[model samples]
Target: MSGSTFALRVAQGVGFTGAAWLSGNIAALSANSVPAIISSVREDNISPNVACKQWRNMYEAGKTQNPPIAFATASSFAYVAWSVRQIPRSLAASAAYGGFGMYVAAAVLTLSIVPYTVAAMRPTNNALLELAESKGDRVTSSAEVEGLLGRWTTLNWARSLLPLAGGFAGIAAALL
Candidate 1:
């Protein structure tokens, strides 16, 4: 009935979709890319160069979906930003305000990771991207690629937690 109620619903929807996209990205990395990299490194059946190429190929393919996913994630934040202002300052008796608070927390929590990711992970990501796009010899050796990917995957896990939490929080907010 209220604007906050509507906003919470929007946040819930957007957050869930965004979270699902993010999870898929993680799942692909976990299920496919990471294992492939490990297999490439340890086993003689797959050469390091071949594996690196596969990894780079897959990495580039995966990146194509990022823009839409990023937009979806930002949409959730937008809903929260719009809705929170509708909530009153006096939170003593308002359930709607409480719910909005959770929604805001969801956005804030998720957004908090962005800066760290941009600042910390950007260079490594750029390097990998360049490798992915490169047609000739890789800039780094296979061992280094493996290390970089391992670090990226580890950081990705950390990055994933926030939107997941935000999605759940948004759901709770909507229900409340």
Candidate 2:
């Protein structure tokens, strides 16, 4: 048993499982809501400014939140635990060991979203925030915000897909 402390294994399990659930939820939530934004504007002819404003507010609020805190914390702990000692392993424990590796991969991949967001999306995000703050509800029609929103929508998919992968990895870990 490679001195696989019960506590370390448990923490790894939590980290990977939490990553799966949290990342999956974040990805699903983003995907589900994006269509609604587009639909509401096209179907109802709602103002783009209003939509942008809503999105800006949501982004601002979400920025302060940590949806992946559980995954992060657990993963961090698991990493630390592993640094001290690799989780004990054997062919019999392949399911768990493999799953743990996947979870770690998930964490690594999920973190990759930061660079894309910072490089590609942050500019547009900042502009949208400023526009919403300065213009508020007065801007009429959706055309004004289309390009930024479009870019945002597209880049967001990149951010979301990794977590989805992590989530599936977590599921594998949990089952195996």
Query: For model 2, how does the per-residue alpha-carbon lDDT over 77-106 read when each residue is reduced to its tens digit?
Result: 446335433546666476656666765665
Candidate 1 lDDT, tens digit per residue, 52-169? 5676676666557654575567578667756665766664436677676777776665555566568876877776666666666644576777777777777767766766776677
Clashes of each: 0, 3
Weakest lDDT window of 10 consecutive positions for candidate 1: 44-53
lDDT (0 to 1) per candidate: 0.67, 0.61
Output candidate 1 Cα RMSD: 3.8
Model 1, residue 149: distance off in Å is 2.0
User: How close is every model to the real structure, measured as TM-score?
Assistant: 0.69, 0.67
Best TM-score goes to which candidate? 1
The deviation in Å at residue 101 for candidate 1 is 2.9
- Give the TM-score (vs. native) of candidate 2: 0.67
